[model samples]
Structures are given as structure tokens and as C-alpha cells.
Target: IDVDKSVDLTNCDREPIHLLGHTQGFGCFIALRFDWIIAYSSANTNDYFGADSDDVIASPLKNWIDPQTLHDIRSAYQASTITGRNERLFSRAIEATGVPVDISIHHNGTFIIIEFEKITDDRVPEDSFVRSMLSQFHRYSDSQELINSTAQYIQFLTGYDRVMVYQFLPDGAGEVIAEAKNENIDSFFGLRYPASDIPKQARALYLKNLLRVIHDVDSEPVPILPEAEDAEDSIDLSFSTLRAVSPIHIEYLKNMGVKASMSVSLIINGKLWGLIACHHYSPLIPSYFVRTELELFAEVFSLELSSRLMREREDESNRVRNVHNQVMASIGSEGSLLGLLEKQFDTMRALIQCDGIGAVIDEDYRTAGTALSADWVHQLTRYLNRQASSEVITVDSLEKVLKNYDTSSDKIAGVLAIPVSKSPRDYLLFFRMAQTQTVNWAGNPEKPVSFGPNGSRLIPRSSFALWQQTHDDRCEHWSDVDVRSGDSLRVTLLEVIIRHFQERSELQS
Candidate 1:
């Protein structure tokens, strides 16, 4: 007797007789043999199977045969014991509803939400419950070293070539505040990108979609429409992942030799903060499971990072305000304005990450505490004497266009010169460099630049020189935008400095 248990099983049965057991399979002639079986949860048939009385259904398939079918079934069955059980469960729900779509997740700060909608492609609204939990975790964070540490942690977690704290600028430009990059790639530690790199439309799309996966830039195209349906036209790129990259953009990445890029947009305070951009040189594909895990971890990291940044900004603001107040008071007390400014260098140096601090004042362009050796200063004197020097102007100029300006043959690696108030008044300036230590300007630093027992300056050579040659358009030999008022730290410092001076002026009057 053959047993067939399909939708129409009754039609396949030839003769039906004897006593029957509901689930234990005890039919008369085939008493000990079980052919036609209906098991709800296996435990319901435990009597004949000799299963322990307390045993529950361990699996839906209880020792069934047919090797190929068993292998296929097991392959499709993802145990709920895994980390993404919730996503898998959601996938099942969608599958049950007969939807042919795939799901993706978008994350920002402490909030995590499904990138799906009941009737549309938009992401779900923020979950208040998730936000509350995130806030508590942030409160427990160790904020002092959080920015740098988190950058490192997230890079490790996501396996990205580089992880950066990208802050958006007012005119649509973006700048890197902090970074963790691979061994071969140089730091863009303080690099800037035009607002055009990420167009307005791309940003809008990013707002709607939290994450984008570019598995392989060189992957074979999955035809958007059947080749039979339309053989003449190319696919629209806006929504299709398979669309070919625009020619200009492809050439741009090729020029830089960036093979793959994965970017996660980070939103903080309901605004676009920047992104955690991951770069891979070789062709790579991250599995769905890996992507899901990475996103969860990345969300946690981004939240911590945003919280730390905001708090630091606030703290810096208060500190600067206090220092400025003191400066104003000192200016009125018993010292020259230049002297008072000199006294403030300690605080300014600490705040601006500068090794040296100086300014060009009035007609003579007087110098204060030299950040470099006196020998280098003499070389700089020539450039400083020019009636119209880029040293005084805010825009790009002669002082900024060259890579190694100091006639000492030692290049002035970085400088921040700003005309704070202009005219006869003092112009605040700041400078910083990894002394005797060549910066990993063009390629990633596998080893830290070695320095002698006594601190000096790093000699820029090889890749550093090569980088200056190639990126001369963007490189500034002495001037850096890090001191720009728009920087979070600079903004806080200026406010504090201004407030202090205002109070001091009143005290003297």
C-alpha cells in the first residue's frame, strides 16, 4: 500500500479499512507501519514514536527521509536562535502576505526603525520606546574619549576601510572631524568635500533611506526590465541598483582608485551630521546577515558619537567663554593687548591643537610666540612683509597655494590665520603640526612617524610630497580651515572669547 498525503490524498488511496489512530498511525493491516501521517507538532504522535512524555516538537521535520528534500528544507530554515530573529520573523510575515519585496533598515543615533511602510516605500516613523532606551545608554557613555574610540570601534565592527565623523557645512560642503582608516590609505583627517560631491537629491534620498548597499560596483547588471521587453534603452538609475554609474563619477573614483564605497548616513538632532563611509579596494559582497548585524552595531556607535559631540561642543563653549572673560579682565588690568593675547596662547593652543600660534597685526604684521624655530621665522618674514599677503586674507592666496613655503626648506605643514576683527585690532591665529613627525597625508600610516627624544617636526617626503603634488588644488601648505568660526569648537571658542572681552571692556570703562 502506497501513501500519498497531498491536497488530494483521498483520491490516491485504494482501499480503506480497519481501526485507525488519530495521530499515532495504528491502522489494522499496516498496524506497525505508518504511511499516511498527519503530525501537528510531533509531540501529538509521541506514543508510537517512543518520544519522552515531556518532549516538545524540536523540529517540524522529525527524522523524515529523501536526502535532497531534507537538505533543501534545512537550508531554508533559519533558526530563531540567531541575532536577526526579529528580521527573519518580519520576513516571514511579509512572505505570508505574498509580497515579493525585500526589506532594509535605516538607523540614526539611538533610534532603530524598519525601512518599510504599510503601503509605501518610506521608512516607519521613529519608535519612542527605542528612543527612550537609547537615551539611557548614552547617559552611561564615557564621553571624553568617545569620539575617537567610537570611530575605531565602528570601523572594526563594520569592517569599513575608513570611518569618519563627517560634519556638514553651511554652503553644502562636508568636512572630516575625526577618522579611523586602513593601513594603506592616508588620512583625510581634516579633508573637505564640495557640497556638489553629494548633491541635494542624493541627500534627500539618503534622508528617506538610512543605508545603501553597493555590493559590487562591477557586478553584472540585473536587467531592470526583461531584455525581451525593451532591448533599446538603458535602465533608470534613481531606484535601480543595477544601473551603470554615471561616466564622470566613475572617472572620479577611478582617478582616486576607490573600488567600492559603502556609506551610512548619520542624522543627529534631526539634522544630517554626515556619514560613516566604508571603502573596500577589492570586489566584495556583504551577506544580508552580516549587513544586518553591522547596521545594528553601527546604530549604537553613531548614537554614542553624536551624543559625545554635542556635549563636547557645549563644554568647549563654556570653557572658552570663561577664558575670554579672563582675557578681557587682564587687558584692562596692567598689560599690553599683545601681551594679554600672548598670555592666552596656552588656552588657545590647547583648544586649537596647535604647536605654534602667531598673528599678523596692523601695518608691520607683528609676530608673537613663534610656533616654529626662529630660523624658519626669518624665512617667513619675507612672505609676511608683502603689503598684500594671503597671510591676512580669508580666501585662498599665495601663502596657501604652495606646499612648502618656509624658505628654511622645512615646510609649514599647517596653519590657521583668521582676521578675527581686522584693521588695527588683533587678528587671532592658531597653528598645529605633528612635530618632526611626517603626517600620513597621502597614504594610510601603517606605522606612526618616529620622532627624536627632543620634539621637532616631521619631514614631509615620498607619499606626502606626492600627495601635495596631486591634491595641490585642495592642499593648503600653511592654512587649514580647522580654525574657521564655523567649526563647532571654533564657534564655541569665539563666543566665549567675545563674551569675555565684552565683560572686560566694561570693567575697564
Candidate 2:
């Protein structure tokens, strides 16, 4: 891919970032073949190794480092190969410059890539400090409390201008659910950003690489010498610690008045769930050790979050199940499904979290909570029956699904239809009232594209002002637990309907 080619929002996702053939200036990279011979080196290798690319390329690894350092590299290489991950050697002395540096070694299929960054901050957090942070996390069982505490702890540790827990919504947009920022800076809490801000390819890379750091967005990238004639065949830097930043992304950060940034992926069940995004207003290059610690923190946080969500789901399921058992017991004692539901309508509504509940049994319609006209309930039942599926049907926006219906007056925006019988198409429908709310966006999301430096390509918006948008004609989305409860209720009601018919037939005979 041509890095300098003009691109618009439509084609930006096709950018080949892994084949950029460069590294950040803060660190130097070297790729060694299987025989320990250097195959590729960053153009700025002489700055650290005191050897030009011409002299280092094709040379044995022993030519640059002392024998002891060479032995250590080999050991780290072996460990990386065994673990299938990058191995780190911190605070190692470079014999040529006599400077202490941190080394990261990894095997990229055909070559061993080694990255070096000079040691700047040698300070390590005390064990007690780490324990204290973990203990803070342990004190919060609520998801929001945990998320907010994470932002606070990260900002406290890194001293960034701002740290946000940005969660991905269903529409691919991101929302800043929690934030910690310096007193002088404006808050970005509760603000949303369009999906274009982080394109699809960028999200895929974040999933593969758990952490990314942009030390200095304005610094020039050091090109890799002997750049592959064909960009597709360039050395893959997918896992490099010092991979060059995409030009467009640099422009994005600059527009936001940021000089440095770091993002830690929060993955759940092998999916990209959210991000821990940190921004610095000035150039800041954290030591590799500190970055590594942050990576560990993100991993531990993801696990705890996944476990907490699963436990909450289980508790909700248990509560719904208890309500369902009560409803079933009442039906058995009354020997009439309609009689039991009409008498204990509120209890039936508790089977799921919804604003109202309605049931349609052979020519009879019963409703509780929010009132719905019998004609409208019958019309919705006919609409659902046409689908010809026995499974639960959930719709968050009734207008989107039912085109000609006048749903604005009813103010019921969501529906969960559980099919109880196939012949008559009896349904137990859960309805939710429409809600109107304001969304705070970091900028006008619709105007994301603007002329770039060349005026030919589309770049990110140049502003970060708060833009508010009012959203209506929708209700609270039905969660996975709600759907599951609906399905469970569907199955139980089907069994009851079948037995009732069987007993009626026997009595008539």
C-alpha cells in the first residue's frame, strides 16, 4: 500500500499498517536471521550501536555486543520461542555506548526481532503500592465502581493528563464511561466518539496487540533500511514494541492537542470489549518496564471484569427463575393460565425486566402494567405470527420493524415476543417505554471527515469540543439475560398449554 496515497473515509480501513517498514525514533530495531546474522536494522542504528546500517547488516550478532550480552540474547530468544511471546531483558548495559537499556526479543516466524530502548526511568513501584491498587479494585464489586477505580489508578500511576475507560457500544461507537484527568484539563466523561475515530483495521490490531504506546507523535519515524521493494513483503512489525505510528493517526492525536498516548485493550471472551486510553499533553516516553506493568494490569482487570459480569448474569437468571416458578405454581393451582395471569399480573411481569407484559391466548388478550389497546396487541401478534419462527423475537425499536404502524402515540418502543403456541400463535409480549436522552460527543460525529494537509485526503476532525445530540424513538436495549429468560418462559408456557389441551380433550371424551 502507498503510505502517501490520498485516502477517504471509505478506503482508510485498507491501510496496511504492519508493513510500514519503520520504527519509532525512541527505540531501534534489528531483525536477525536463524544464523544470528543481521538481516534488517533501523536506519538510526548508528545512534545507539555506534555502527551504521551498512556495517551492521549481514553481520553476526556477536560483532556488536559482548559475548556475555550475546549469551543473554540467545537465552531470551529461546525463552521467547518456548512461550510464543516477546521476552524482556531490563536494564541491560550496551557495551558500545555503555548505556543501560531495556531489550525486547521476539520471534516473527522467520527472524528474531530485537528492540532496544534506553533506560530513562529506573524507578519501580514498590510491592505495597501494587497491592494497594489491587486491594482498591477488590473493594468494588459494582461494574461502574470497578471501571471508575481503574481510570483513577491508571492516571495516578502514569500521571497522564487524562485517562478514560472507553467502552464500545453496539453500534461500534465508543463511550467514555469513566474518566480521570488533571485539574486544569476539561473533562471528557460521558462523551461519545464515532467508530470512524478508530477504524476497523485499528480495532483488529488492538485485539492482536494488547498494548500500544505513541511516545511522541511529532517525532520522525526511523525507516527500516533495505526497505522491501514490494511493500507487501516488508518485515512484519505486527508485534513490534516500537512499530511506527500511522501518519493519519499522528495527525489525529495532534488535532486533539496530544503529544503522547497509550491504549490498553480490554478483551472479554476473545472479543475486543473496550479500551483504557491515556493521553498526555506533552511528549512522554514511559520506560518499557512501566509499560509492561500496565499491560499486566490490563490483563488482570479484564479477567476480573469478565468474572464479575458472569456472576451478575447468573444472579439475574436465578431471580427470574424464582419468579417463573411462582407463576407456574399459580397456574397449576388455578387450572387456568388466563385466570392466574389476570389475578397475579404483576408477578408475571417480574419474569423479565420490562415496563409491561401482555399475553394472547386463543381469542383472549390480557395486559398488565402499561396499558395497550386490545386491537394494537392483536395487530402486533399478527405481525409476529407472520415471521413463522417459534423462537423469541426481540426488537428495541418498534418503528424500525413495523413500518406502517403509528407507534409514536403508544410510546412503546421495544418488544420481546415469546411464542407459546404454534397453531393459534399465542404470544407473551414484553414492552418497554421509549426513552429520550442526550448524548455528549467529543465532536460533531457526522462531520468526521475534513481536508488533510494535502487537501486531497480526508483526515480526522480538528476539534474536540463537546457536541450534544438528542436521541429518541428508542428504549433500553434488551440484554442477553432478558432474552434467555424470555426463552425459558416460552418453553415452560408451551408445556403448560400442551398439558391443558390434553386434559381438556380427555374430559370431553
Candidate 3:
């Protein structure tokens, strides 16, 4: 916890989420080989199974559970192993104790780890709960509404002080789009956090593991017993919901004044698009029943999110398609590329999401909207043709690529261009004006100072002050969908050009 002492900041990413060799104090962790021999235990199995940790380690799974239970478990375990899936066994109460426990089986490549989570009965049917959540999703019209409901629902279920839907931008940085919190806490809605706050590997881990909980940052981590000398001997907990957290992250959370926290992954297309980040101002841990409910809710919400996002993309694609058809129709009738292109200039610029567009064919040039001067456009077009790599070239910063032209950045900061013909140097280009804006960050997001406890090692920054930056060289960002639309338009233009050439040849003959 010493800020002056140095620590290897890189280890935050290399901490091996899979082989953490520990568990958060919410469950009994037991590991067994494929042959059913016990490999390791969390040393706290007595609280759950009435057996000593050492007694369970060197025994078979059949010693504690009945044969029927082991058979059911082994069969489910074997099936999941083949499919690379996880399965939850039954929930049963301890003999004469009335304490309910939920068991789940998942493989970690080396051993099949079984977790026994002590849970309280909520009496809510799984199907009913899922249907209720899904029904709520279908009622929402857009992603923003759904995210708002999800944050509120999670906050209600977990009783957290604040719950926010943290979505990642094109860059690794994140923004809180939807938030639900108690009146006492300050709002973090719309606040942007730097990418380094959650390192790259940590995000990968969140994708692999759906949920992670830190019950109390102040509690000491309970290390795995008989710690092996070699790292290979350690048990992997990549799929573990109760894996102990990293100390660096603990300090990071403490700096934010968050004593406890949990995150539910919001995945889209097998990738992490966002997270339901819940923060607690004080130590508060939900029972396994509540945790399980929130995890299920997140899964259902992710599917709905994927569907909504696809619809939005399809809407954009349809708009581009309409403009493509309109432009093609005009060009087909006129046959004079410059005349037709000038007539449909506004629609073409809209297709590319740009304010200006320019086209050149057989030395006939046309410009519209906020386009640069014709002379400058002609020079830029010639330069672009010489340096062209593909049929469609996009540059977010044109000045960097075209260093010879210092005056070009005033009007044409970014460009998306498509080559219609090579011999005549014919092309269509969409230009975006220079746009500058402020970027807010959670912290400075720089490399940690090296003068710490471990000889000149990297340590986490202690202050989480709000930092802002102003940019000048960058223009409006381009999306993959935008590039695809441009690519499709290029193919259409090529086909039209081919047909136009064929018609001219026939007339000449």
C-alpha cells in the first residue's frame, strides 16, 4: 500500500488470472484431476462440507458426496469438458443444518475445479426471472434505454451504492453511459476513464470471466496451501468467480474511495463491448443467490444489446445504400460523369458522412459544400493517386500523409477517397474539416514513476485527478462501417464506369 515503494506495474497484466492460487472468501474451492483424484482445496472446506482441508485434498470426490451425486457430476463434467462449457450442478441443503449450497463444475485445462458457494434461498424461479428481464428488454426502444434499465436493475438487486454501464470507446478509454446510484454519492455519468485504468489484459480477463467480485479490499488474501515452487503446479482460476484480486487494483480502487466492487461483462459478438460496474462506498458483499441472479441478468442483457446494435448498423447501411442507388441512377442516365456527379453532390457527400465531396474525370473537376479550392483539390488528387495503396484510401489526418502541402489542413483535415479510373486519374474524395475538442481522462494516464520500493519499478499512480486534453491535428473519427460503405460504393462506381466505357465504344464504332 506504500505509494513511495516501487512495484512491477507490468505484472498487473501478467498476474495470470488463470493461476491465481487463491479464492475470495465467498466459497469453497476444490480441484480434482480428470480421474477424480483431489488435487487441491482452499483449506476452508470445513465451513461448507464438514471436512478438514487436508482430509479432502488426498481423497476421492466419492468420499464426501454419494455415488449417485458423483456419477451425475462426473457425467456433466465429462460432457462440459468435451464441449468446453460450464455446468452448474444442483442446489442442496447441508444435512440437519438447513444451509443451502450451489455447486458448479468447470475445467481449467489441468483440473476440473468445483466451487461450493453457500447461498440463501430466494425462491425465485430461473425461467420466470429470465423471462421478466427479457420482457423488459423487448419493451425498450433503443440501447440507451436498455442500458439505463440494466444499471438500475443491477443496482436494485446488488444494493450497491452506484451502478454504471461503462462502455468502451473506439480507443481503449471508457465512458459511463448509464448510471444508477443512491442520493448520497456523486455522479460519474458521462465521465471518461483512461484506458490504463483497466489494463489490456484485465479487459481480456473480464471477457473470459463473466463476473468478478471484490468483497472487501481490506481483507488479507488467503493463499492456496502447499504453494508449489514451479508456476506450472498452480491451479488455474480463469473461470473462477471468486479469484482474489490484484493488490495494485486494490490500491487503485481505494484511491477512488471504493471499498468493494463488482463487474458483470456486457459482451457483443464474443467481444467485451462494455461492463456493468457496481461500486460500494463501504464493504458490502451480496449472497451467492443475488450474485447468480445479476450474472444471469447480464447474460440476457448482452444478447438484447447485440440485437439492438445490429439494427442501428443496418439503419446506417440502408441510408448509404439509398444514396448509392440515387447517385448510380443519375450517373447512368447522364453518362457525363462530371455533370451527373455535380447534380447529385449533396447526396453523395451525405453518403460518406462528410461536409464536402470532390470528383475528377478526364481533367473535368467538380466540388461542392465545404470543399477546398479546385487547384488545391487537383494537386491533392494527383498526390493521392501517386501514393495510393488500395482502391479506397482513408486518412484521419491528411497533413501527416501529405507533408509537402502545409496549407491543406485548414479545410481538408481528413479524407476518404475512391479511385474510379487509373489512366485518366479520375477519383471521388470525401473531405472532413479540421475538428478540435477536449478529451477528459480519469487521470494523467502516464507511466508510473519509478522511484518506489522495488528498485526503480513501475507503481500505480496515487492521485485520480480529472485530466483534460485539447487536440488539433485529429478530425472526426471514422468507423469500420463507414469504410465498408465506401468500399461498397467504390465497387458500384467501377461497374458504372465499365458500362459507360462500353457504351462510348459502341457509339464510336
lDDT, candidates in the order shown: 0.42, 0.79, 0.73
How well is each residue in 1-509 modelled by candidate 2, as lDDT tens digits? 12223344546577788889999999889999999999999999888788899998999888778788889999999999998778888878778777677899999888899999987654564343455667777789688889998899889888889999999977676889999999998888988776677888888988988898999998999999888988798898888999998888888888889999999999999989999999999988677877887887888899888989888878877887787677666554325667655665676677776778888888698888774568777777777888989999988777776766545687677789898877788778898876433346566445544567735545565222211121346666777767888898877777766666676677779
lDDT digits (tens) for residues 244-310 of candidate 3: 8876677777767899999889888888999999999888777655666677778878988889888
Query: TM-score of each candidate?
Result: 0.47, 0.80, 0.74
Off by over 4 Å in 3: 1-13, 34-37, 49-52, 60-79, 89-100, 120-128, 168-175, 183-204, 325-382, 397-400, 404-414, 420-477, 488-509
Candidate 1 residue lDDT tens string, 249-360: 3333444556666666777666667776666666543433344455555566667767777777777767666755664455443444456556766666665555467644
Stretches of candidate 2 off by over 4 Å are: 1-10, 121-132, 135-137, 169-173, 191-196, 325-379, 396-401, 405-414, 421-423, 431-442, 445-449, 453-479, 491-509
For candidate 3, list the clashing residue pairs, or say none: 5-452, 5-453, 6-452, 6-453, 18-237
- Where does candidate 2 have its weakest 10-residue lDDT segment? 462-471
TM-score of 2: 0.80
lDDT of 3 at 104: 72
Model number with the top TM-score: 2
Residue 309 in model 1: shift from native, Å? 2.2
